[model samples]
Target: MGIGNWELGIGNWELGIGNFFLVFLVFLVFLVFPIPPFPHTPYRGSS
Candidate 1:
C-alpha cells in the first residue's frame, strides 16, 4: 500500500511538471511572436 501511494505521488508530480513546462513554452511563444491585432488594442488601452 505504501509503495503504491508513493508511485502514484511520483506520477502526479511528473504530470504537474510536464503541464507547467508546456504552459511555459506556450507563453514564451506568444511573447516572442505576439499577435499584432490582439495585443495592440490592449496595449493602447492600458498605456
Candidate 2:
C-alpha cells in the first residue's frame, strides 16, 4: 500500500511539472506574438 501511494505521488508530481512547462511555453508564445484583438496594455486604463 505504501509503495503504491508513493508511485501515485510521483506520477502526480510529474504530471504537474508537465502542465507547468506547457503553460510556460504557451505564455512565451503569446508574449512573442500577441493577438491583435486584445489590447497590449489591458492593465493600464490610459490606453
Which candidate gets the maximum lDDT versus the true structure?
A: 1
Model 2 Cα lDDT, one tens digit per residue, 1-46: 3334455556798865666666567557667877677666433344
Cα-based lDDT for every prediction: 0.60, 0.59
lDDT of 1 by residue, 1-47 (tens): 33344555567988656666665775577677786767654334665
Compute the lDDT of residue 5 as modeled in candidate 2: 47
Name the weakest run of 10 consecutive residues (lDDT summed) in model 2.
38-47
TM-score per candidate, in order? 0.48, 0.50
Best by TM-score: 2
**Alpha carbon lDDT of residue 37, candidate 1?**
62
Worst 10-residue lDDT window for candidate 1 reads 1-10
After TM-score superposition, what is the CA distance of residue 7 in candidate 1 from its true location, in Å?
A: 19
